[model samples]
Target: MTYKLGLTGSIGMGKSTTARMFRDMGFPVWDADEAVHRLYASGGAAVAPIAAMFPTALDNGGIDRKALKLALANDPEAIERLEAVVHPLVAKDRENFLQKHSDSPLAVLDIPLLFEKGSEWQFDGVAVVSTDADTQRNRVLSRPGMTEKHFEMIHARQMPDAEKRARADWIIPTDTLESARAAVERICNEIVTDA
Candidate 1:
């Protein structure tokens, strides 16, 4: 049987980078964010339903993320409504990914909201990438158009880093690239050994 591992972290915690490291080490990785991006693109499964739900959020050919964000901000129930339209499509995409990688000894599903969505039970194990608050804040602030309010808003929606770490089967501290890479290697080695 294949080992399915779920990888997650709060914003600016190097989750994507660590996922790439897993890919580099030969694990097939399915990225939830990428799946959503594809789903929201023109001719994608999510486009028509999302357009029906929020017509103003559709651009020339695809879903306008900024407009969607504005809609969510304006309506207290908008996120739940939006998820109702999009979550099933994302779930289907993940299912397809799992089917494609079924033969692999181990595979990773990179879901930013795995814990928040209560989908961690689907994985054999879960890994969280973490860093100090200062580093995380600084990294997020360095991104274009990132502000304190935006950071706080994102943070409010996610589980705290401490809580995430506590729940993680493997905790990777990504204070530096070298350390993060070492941790990834170690985790891969351990998983291989266990399997």
Candidate 2:
């Protein structure tokens, strides 16, 4: 069976880049964020229910993520409600991914909230990318619409980088593209050999 590799990192920690490296290295990746976006754009499966909960976020064709952000901003309970609707959809999609890729020698689940969502149980092993705090802060703060206050709020919701580093079965410190890809290749080779 394919190894179910779980990959995660904090915001601005190069998760998208790492996920690309994994894909380049030929591992099938199930991206949870993409799944969420899919659900958002998909039929009335979950979006309508979510719209019922937060009406301002849905319109013409799909959910307006920015509008949803505005509605949920500063409202902790609003986030909980959003998660209640979206998480299940993501979960079912993840299960579908696993089932579809069951025969591959290695598969990856690119889950941003893997730890926060208690999703470790679904993986053969977890790899977390880490970088220095200053690097992370600068990288995140450079993004459009990313305020320090919002960064802090998101960080507060996530497991600390240090703690995530400590908990990971494999740690990839992504300071550069080449080095990060090397680490991903190493992990892939290791998993393929071991499996």
Candidate 3:
């Protein structure tokens, strides 16, 4: 059986970079964001249901994320409704990935909201990537089209970094690439050895 490790972090915490480190180490990584993107792309599983719920979110036979964001912003409950349609699909995608890598000793599931969604239970262990608040804010704000307000909104949705670290089986400090990579290697060694 594969050991499933749920990797998570708030925006700008270097979760994507950490996921890449795992990939570099030859571990199969299933990215939840990428899975959602696949689901939102044209001819994907979520287009019809999402379009049915918010026609304005439909663009060229696919779900337009920007338009969906606007719709969700206008309606306080829209996020929940959207999740209701998408979560099952995402879960199915993850399940398929896990099954595909069943023989592997370790598989990483890169889930941005793993803790917030109460999905930590689904994995054998959880790793939370984190950085100081200032670094996180700076990294996020430096991104194109990222405003302070947008950063705050995204940050608010995630569980606090401290809380996540407290709950994590391993905490990967992403203050620098070297540190993060070292943590990843350590975690990988431990898990693979035990597996």
Please write out the lDDT profile of model 3 over residues 170-190, one tens digit for every residue.
999999999999999999999
Q: What is the number of backbone collisions in each predicted candidate, taken in the order shown?
A: 0, 0, 0
Better of 2 and 3 by lDDT: 3
lDDT of 2 at 126: 99
The list of candidate 3 runs beyond 4 A from truth reads none
Off by over 4 Å in 1: none
Q: Quick one: best TM-score, which candidate?
A: 3
CA lDDT of each prediction against the hidden true structure: 0.91, 0.88, 0.95
Which prediction has the highest lDDT against the true structure?
3
Relative to the unseen true structure, what is the Cα RMSD of model 3? 1.1
Model 1's lDDT to the true fold? 0.91
Q: Using TM-score as the measure, name the better of candidate 1 and candidate 2.
A: 1
Decoy 1 TM-score against native: 0.95
Range of the 10 consecutive residues with the lowest summed lDDT in candidate 1: 69-78
- For model 3, name the residue pairs that clash: none
